[model samples]
Target: MKINQYIRQAQYKKGFASIILIGVIVLVALGGYFTLKAKQKSSPEQTSTTATDQKVYTISDTNKSTTNQLIAESKIIESLKTNWQSIQALIPFRPGHPGTVAWLSPYSVQFIGKNNLLVGFEDGYNPGVAVLNFNNDQFKILETFKNQAVFTFSDWQSLINKYGNSSYPVSTYTVSLLRNKQIVSFQDLINVPENIFLKNY
Candidate 1:
């Protein structure tokens, strides 16, 4: 009878152990599933591509990709232009204090993927693009392009033709292209892609 009792106790312990082991496995699997789900929800594609107060574009060359880049801004046309691609990304502002941007002026800010750009203005206030040039690798703000915001349909049409957008967001924006304060126009601009000059530059 004692032998039987001992056998029964051993069987009970084995069964209990089996139950505990299976429970542990289930708990671990559930934990892993939740952890993986959390990670999947936070990916780079879900991240904002633009810089603070700027539009961010991921431009790729044949062999390389650039990020946070600041390029020269101009009113010229480009055949193969690299813009925000979507005017929805632009943040227009009226001119601010010169210190609004770290390296440039305080009129408008544009994101050149890897670099933050400051756009300057001629009137020291207003939202407009400067046809800029580059001297010794530095951006030089040149001519300013302005539409009357004329409060008229014809005025709207003119801006739409120039900026290539009839529905661009209108606001007081700021950025300053850092270069010779006296320089203006795309003529002196350097590092500009030829395609930008050809079509929608």
Candidate 2:
């Protein structure tokens, strides 16, 4: 009777050990499953954020690859020559108007991509630049700057960054050229001391 009791006790302990092992295995499996499910749920959100962060700038509706800068500039020059009256009328401070301190004229013309003409103007005192788009038998001014806005390097950088749509950014090369021309025009006025100072009698 004592041996039989001992045998029964040993069997009971073995059965308890088996149940504990099975519970541990089940808990581990459940933890792994939940971890995998969490990763799957977060993957799409991560992908969506990446897509939004990567905004791409592109050249639109122009022969960027084939258009020569010189030839494109010529076209803008011809257009300006032919439509000088109408174009000047569209600008502020017309040459003959009262209180007009500046006479605006196209100082520099560059052919950037997207049928856009980057033009610089001088008004004797202040220099300005504009990006003109030719469409439907007319020229439209897309962007314009005058005075300190066109004079400083910081403003130039800001204009380069801000002068375009979300899809099409302005060309930095053309903006640099326009800035250089405006600076030269400004220098032409200031570099002459006689013009700025009264003549000694």
Candidate 3:
């Protein structure tokens, strides 16, 4: 009877050990499956967040660049206006026609080096190009080509191609006055349906 009880106890011990081993294997497998599932679920969310961040950064950079460009353009326009005003003040228009009355056409202003500029203006009467030189904080008329015909876009392009060589830096800005007296850039004028080459002469 003692021997039989000992055998039964040994069999019970072996069964318990098997159960524990099987339980450990099952727990390990479940842990691995859950970890894999969690990683798969988080990956898409992380990718989406990263993409959103990149898009936001790109838009911010573009806005900053656009703002800076607009500021620079405004400064250039102000400088052009100031210089033109100074020139008009120094060289008064003939009697009965003020400088303000003589500047009623599309104008092209080009800033050359060494504080020099070339300005083309068309006023119902006098339409031509003039070279302005800034010296000692004062503006002086270097040369003037008066009574020129109205030049179209093609004409201006032809002139530029004829005169502007690879060696010459011909950076310029053109502006036109609207019927409402509002000044607009030449680039903007091209998009309008109205004819931009309305000759006063």
- Each model's C-alpha lDDT? 0.35, 0.50, 0.52
**Judged by TM-score, which candidate is best?**
2
Local distance difference test, candidate 3: 0.52
- Tens digit per residue, CA lDDT, model 3, 1-201: 999999999999999999999999999999999999976664333455445434433545657654443344335545556666556544334213345453543366654445555566656556666666655655577765556534566754444454334344444455443444554433321112233333431
What TM-scores do the predictions have?
0.28, 0.40, 0.37
**TM accuracy, model 3:** 0.37
Per-residue alpha-carbon lDDT of candidate 2 for residues 118-155, written as tens digits (9 for 90 to 100): 56665655656676777765798787655422334454
Question: Candidate 3 clashing pairs?
Answer: none
Q: What is the lDDT of residue 104 in candidate 3?
A: 47
Q: Rank the candidates by TM-score, best first.
A: 2, 3, 1
Better of 2 and 3 by TM-score: 2
Maximum-lDDT candidate: 3
After superposition, the stretches of candidate 1 with alpha carbons farther than 4 Å from their true spots are 43-59, 62-65, 68-201
Off by over 4 Å in 2: 1-69, 93-102, 148-154, 161-201
Worst 10 residues of 2 by lDDT: 189-198
